[model samples]
Target chain A: MTALPKPQTLSLTVNSKPVSMPVPQGVSMQEFLHEWLGLTGARMGCGQGICNACTVMVEEPGKLPREVRTCITGAHWFEGKTVRTVEGHARQNADGSLTLSPVQQAFVEGFAFQCGYCTPGFVTAATVLIERLRAAPVPREAVERVVSEALDPHICRCTGYVRYHTAVRDLVLATPGLVTA
Target chain B: MRTFLLTLAGLAIGGTALAGLVFSGALNRSVVSRTVETPLTAEQIKALAPQGAKVAAAADCYACHTARGGAPWAGGMPFETPFGVIHATNISPSREGIGGWSRAEFHRALRDGIAPGGRHLYPAMPYTSYRGMTEGDVDALFAYMTTRTPMPVGNAKNGLAFPFDQRWTLAAWNFLNLPASVAEPNPERSELWNRGRYVTEALGHCGECHTPRDLTQGLRTSKALTGAVIEGLEAPDITPAGLTHMGFSAASLATFMGSGLSAQGAATHQMFDVVHFSTRHMDRADLLAMAAYFFDRDALTDEAPAVLPEPAPVAADVAARAQATYAGLCAGCHGAMGEGIPHVSVAMRGNASLRTASPSGFVRAVLAGLPAQSFPDGERMEAMPSFAADLDDAAMADLTNWMRAEWGGQAPTVQTRDVAAVRATLTTRHAAGD
Candidate 1:
């Protein structure tokens, strides 16, 4: 019998937590996060690259920020990169109780989800959007423009677009001292 | 409070305008530049084209004409339909591939079902729906295609065996029902309506499945969007009459077109493929436009009046026959009253799945049965047994007819010939792993 190949392990930071997992060759980042780590937040609506449901931020030190589709991307390709998921936002308070992040809170309050299947994707995308906006709070015209751009890849079947727009808008509006101008 | 109100109003208006501007500009940009020149110069046509062209190339067109490795677009793809198998011609740049044809001839092929040589192409080419394409886009596609390196693949002669192979009859069929120059959308309608019309007619090719076909295989305009079974898959009626429980509002249809999962049902089969390629890439406004046009069409007109159908009294013989079949096969899972078990049996009566125009699904369910499901919601899991091996065609037909007539549905009777044809096709496709 032929000798079994040695398994390879890669170290990566997920949602700010350092984790190491053994991954086979050609395993996508989406598969690695979903199957190996049990993070089902990223949905696989369409296996093709066209649907952006599996978008994830890949953070590499001293490099431009990159957003990659976990489904198409191989786990070995993200050997040392930090990845964030919707589960990462459940923050522990000073007293040790978990609190929902602002993006999560906004989503719930806005009644954004209908079927709630695509909700996690929206939350993660909104988290990214909020971070981007805080760095540069765009003009009101730009706000709509930016929101559309940020949410373009996400596909939501039930709530139509009204609730998603409402949630994102509310999140941006709630940011104190942020000016429309 | 006053200051906040004013600010909010101003922001809303400004945001709407800016968003509109950006979307319109993006659409215009995509429209204006049809071809993108890449650095690499591969002689292969598919290699040189952009992503959209590649997707278009991978379409059903490449399966046949190019099967024998002849010049691209030189028609030689053979399509087997209920009528017969017809060979597709060469569409490449060679003398055989419309080398002498002008832009009008190409447009005629797409929109009017007419070839450059003034011959009528079979409806299998989908020219009826393709004609809905905008003149400019069609021209661009032609330009991009002609620029590609021409292959010398020869055409395959049609394998059609008899009276069915007579090509002249296709002309009469075209004359009777060919779409007249891709009917221009009512200009007075909203931009969304116009866009939807273009997408539905040209790009989406909804008629390829939704519209019922005549005996000659031409689309029956009278029953447009009524829904039909294409390639074993039942293309659900997309009209607002809402055959399925999920009644699609214009907005909901737009969302479904964009995402594939609607409140009605998850996109499967060819629709799933369409969403994967075409609709998902569409901008929200375009999707909305398609929704607006479709929802506004006469196809949405309801056939059922305010009053429900008068309950049909089951004939003693019919009832006994149906009862025996149901008891032996289905009653174990679906309760005797047809109320259905919580997660096991789907009720035969009044179920939207049973009411669809195409009976292929119902027949398939009775013959081959539903696939096992282990979905998260226990409520969603359901299965049916295949009776193909067990029940004869007559018994299956009687059972289905009984279900429809007894279950408050207005669906017509299904013939055994239809069932046999669909079964044969299904078997061939299964064997081919299509």
Candidate 2:
């Protein structure tokens, strides 16, 4: 048997909390988030980069946003970085009650999921889409194109696509002054 | 020892240098140096190319085109079907490929079903779905192919036997069947809906396998997304009812397309192939658009209208003939009503197994006795009997046809030749597997 390398201690921000964990040499961001931290927001579908179920945003201090697939990406790649996941979308109020993010609310209201397996991935992707659309509201015709382009990496098998489309459309329309009637 | 180490280091350095040379294109020149290859300037290639041609090339048009060799687009790659094999032709610049083809002819070949030679290219080329591609995209695909390093090769001969090999018969087949002409997206629908329809119906070609086929192997448009068996496993209905059957929502469908998994079930087999090839690259919005169309489309209300209903009570003469054959051959195991004996035989009537798309299976079941199995419960079941020596093709066809007509359910006729062809192919497949 080959002698395995010693585990490395790493610190990273997940859902805004700085957490430390022992990461193996080839551990992926998704595995770390899911197995070690118990954050099941990022799904594991096709471990290859093809499926976007493991997509997560790496927040850097001053660089352009980069979306990485946690499944294929190594945990070491997230060292000293803040990663946002579906869990980060909700907030706890002063009274200890949680409020759903607009994107998450839109998904529920739009009836976006049937089996709910691919729901988290879609939510994560929609969060990213909403952020990008806020920076620059796209034309109504371009919304579908942009959303498709943005979510091209994720896969869903149920509901076909109507509800997901409606979810994104609702999110975009709800954004203040972003979408004109 | 020192000298050996030094020599090893030198060899490693040389290998890295050689790899760099190959990576940088220096080795490319040496490899092609002896070939009569006149390199065209990038500008020249671009100028001569039609729009969207480059994209088509990237889509791996050559993978199928150059399989057998000929002019590109001449058609001759063998695409295996449940019925038989269909070959793709060479789509080249030669007269056989597209040499004499006009722009309109080329457009028809790409977007329409008409070939330059006025023949209808089989749906195997996916022109049925490719028809939805914008004129610009089609133009680019044409330009890209014409500009390729044209190789002189002949079209591969089709492997189909008589009756199946008749190309002229395809014309009538196309007229009677084939998908409808591509229609522009309705402006009344959302932009997302339009784009989704464009990608799914055209570039994605989801229906090729998902949609059920008629007797002639053409897509049954009226029963779109109802369900069909492709390759071997059933392509589940993506229609709302089918979705409901599987308990998948519109969002779940989009997610599955985007990621190849849902909470309900992970994609397996041919679906995995589809997800990897097509859905993986589709954007979420486009996936949603496809989902939208699928969910909103009407359910398959028209039951296979072509299939005749079950024949009334078997004719007395036919019953007597069938009874004699059944008693002498089958009654020992299968009970009198065709209700198979428990732990001994499989019922012929109302059995899903008998009503499958390929009648060849039933023929095989009859020709080869069913194999015995030892169940976990310790119950032993007898194998089905083989009738190859006992029954001819006509008898087998008649029996199975009667079984379908009498006991199985409403389905179209199964020709004797269809049974024969399936038998031959099954033997070949079984031999290959061994």
Candidate 3:
């Protein structure tokens, strides 16, 4: 067997909470999420980056949101990048009521998922889409086209994107200032 | 006269003997007893409503049983077969429908393809797939269907050719072609696998299109779900082996079922049925279980996925001339590079929708503008504008070839005649009020 690299300590923010941990070189982010962090939301569909099921939001202070696939990439590669995941979409209020993000709420109301294994990726991707649209508002008429282009990379088997499209459109329309006619 | 009579008797006896010997198993197979503990009252039915609805959606009865823009479960869908055209029967609770059906009668029709009063149903009803459904699910389906409001929608008359008009022939066809209705879950498998098998093989009825059929029109078991061509459209192999080659994982398949995009652009054509109906309504756990079961099956050995060749470049003359046509007629929404403005226009580059060996979809989009879709929630979805008057057959072929070749990764050129053929078919279909 090839000699393994020395373990290194890494620090990063996950779903807004900062944490540091020792990581082995070349440990796939997908394995770490499932095995170590116990976050089973990011599913491994193709193991390769093609499916994009393992997509997570890579957030840096001022940069545009980036969707990264954890399946193939090394965990150590993201030494200090802030990441957002599906679990982070809903927050528990002081009264103990959980408030879901707009995208997640839209998905639920639209019946956007059947098996829902891909729901996390779609949620994350749509979240990125909302962020992108906010950064550069497009023509209101371009809602369908813009959303389609943004989430084009994620794979889904059910609803044919009909429900997903409706959900995102509802979000864009419901959340004012995201688009201008 | 005596000798001739003797010869005729011998031939008749021999033929009957042959049929009896060949069809003994099917003819003798035992059907489940359609027993009811008690007549279900409306209150009792109300309790079973949730389960009933789940079963109805699982069987996809509405897809074939209901008419377009017609009352729910009021059959008016027309199906064309080589033998003739047959309309789906009404199964609602009206006098014109199945309002008076008993539980036993419903079970008989579902498992034995025998309707009330001993009427044999046509094989076109996909009773073969339904035969795999367990007794519990069949009961659920019966409750749901029988509970629908009885509409007075008259049934469409079937026009089958000669011998096919006789319903008795269907009995022989069923015996010869269909598996026995009894299903036994594998003792070696887990509950999840059994559920997966039941959903995929029965409720989903995916093999109707996904499985290649033999000359006799029965599923070819050897290559089930490997792929089958339906209505000249490709229902590509969805088997684990086929999917693995495409780099699809369980999660990917689940994603595909949930959203319809798979790294590529969209899942068009018949895949829409599964996405919009069966898989989309299924629970998340069910989808995950299905993916797990599919991946674990021994149906195929892992093979390297087919390598899509890099598309060849377009001819300069075609490209040069088509560029102007594209810029003037197509580029506004599709983008100058054929990359398409997301949501505003579908990207042409790397899009499977435009790169298919079949050009019919592309032709339809151009000739008749894609109509804006109205979702159930009253949302007006995007629409693609038409170029019917602006682009003739020659212009269509030129533009298609250039766009596909330039951005769709070396797609083959389309001929004007092909465009004409598609237009002709579309016109015929529309004229027939399809």
Candidate 4:
């Protein structure tokens, strides 16, 4: 007789709400977000973590938020951590209206995505880069290099990456303290 | 009685003069003076060149002689040593190189550590090991070297300090350490075993890096093939007992020598160069012979460390942090349980580097990372990104100890200082432009 895999208890904060659930051992975070929690904004484009379409923000206490690929990572690995998916980027108002975050707003206005399969990863990665720059700004001349480094790992097939990169660059330039002259 | 005193004084003076000449290597000229003729005709050169080329490959002459982005055998490769920086000389057949050298001069340079004009070569050339090469192999290599396209590059000057700059001092070193005779077939041993010994010792010179050095920096033959630390990395023991402990059978060992990867792990650093330039080009039969000679048996019992070692005691928070780090960064490619992805990464369980007592190899891997390599056998591994900018010394120490204890079955002996030390080696090399 084959033995059943034991369910592991996973406790973490997703989208500012504490979640506690029993997930199967080795269940990827993408599965938990799509099937269990019903927050599927982070698309699973390539299950091998190469595409970065399933990227999400992992925010630790006293540390800057960082991007983690959900497709290849186990849900239990995020235990006791705070995570933010693409759905969490837009703020919900008291009037039940949504206000897009600066990165999301810039992406929408700049038409940074075409098929939108890779937009979520770009948004999360850009958000982290902006947060890092805010804490310690780069020289104005280094903006392009830094932007390329931030988004170089994510693969976008629909758009030639010029639109998304421009959107992020313009957003950083327009923002107050992201870069120095 | 007066006549006897005078005679004794004369004998003492004569004995002292002879000893001085021998120690200074002044007598090497007479010993290496025999002439060997080279092939003049194209047909003769062609017939002899193939075997000569094989001899050169087996001896690994190109890896040292050829500089990165420089002409092959038009040597400008710099080897950093404790004494100084020594550049490999241009051996191409040009007026500026060894074209003017005679066959006897070449032999003297290789076997007697005495170049043309009686200039003593520093031991950095590894003449101590080459001294054991057979005369036929030496002549073959000489013929092959002569065929190389003559590049008009002059030899670079060595940057050695005071006493080391004096080449004559090397004669004393050679007198003290040089092997007495060239490698010969042992009639008592099997033919295959004898061939294996010749390849490993005389041609391949595996002991140059693998064997520990004595206080004088001479190879300690007493502990041959037991392994040693070279250039901040451990060349792990390849002796019979050592290979057995590392879970190597004869077949696996031969595979590893031929390619860079095996069940144990991929070769890194200096050993990678050895495989890429030398052993990979070697004949299959020779590789097997080397393995057989290393194991001393055709088949090994193949006992891996079956019993997992108990985890070393550490603070709960440290272990927890290391697990989280591993899960976050490493698990995406190397499985969550350290099982490792096939053709992607090496499994940590039976990895020979991790299983070793020293954590230097593992620590260096994390810091320097590994370049993607494709083997001749269609095996390839993805490049591992360096985490030097991401992890702090304490974090690295924690992770190394955790991995070693959990999967490697090794003691948690790594500390923050050790990580710092390894990082310093990388920094030093970078500053030196290595």
Better of 1 and 2 by TM-score: 1
Off by over 4 Å in 3: A1-181, B1-44, B181-194, B241-252, B259-263, B266-274, B291-329, B337-345, B354-369, B374-381, B385-424, B428-434
TM-score, B chain, candidate 2?
0.51
Which consecutive 10 residues in model 3 chain B have the weakest lDDT in total?
B372-381
TM-score of 1: 0.44
Model 3 lDDT per residue over B125-154, tens place: 777787787777777777788878888899
DockQ of each: 0.01, 0.01, 0.01, 0.24
Model 4: CA > 4 A from native? A1-5, A13-18, A38-72, A82-181, B1-33, B37-41, B67-78, B84-106, B113-122, B146-161, B165-168, B297-331, B336-338, B386-434
Q: Write the per-residue lDDT of candidate 4 for residues A129-161, one digit (tens) a residue.
A: 999899889999999989998998799988549
The whole-model C-alpha lDDT of candidate 2 against the native structure comes to 0.62
Over 4 Å off in model 2, which ranges? A1-181, B1-77, B92-102, B148-153, B179-181, B261-266, B297-434
The DockQ of predicted model 3 stands at 0.01
Regarding TM-score, does 3 or 4 come out ahead? 4
Docking class of 1: incorrect
Highest DockQ scorer: 4
The complex in candidate 2 yields a DockQ of 0.01
CAPRI grade of model 2: incorrect
- How much of the real interface does each model capture, measured as fnat? 0.00, 0.00, 0.00, 0.24
Q: Write the per-residue lDDT of candidate 3 for residues A100-175, one digit (tens) a residue.
A: 8889889888889899988889998999888977888888889988888767777887645888888898899888
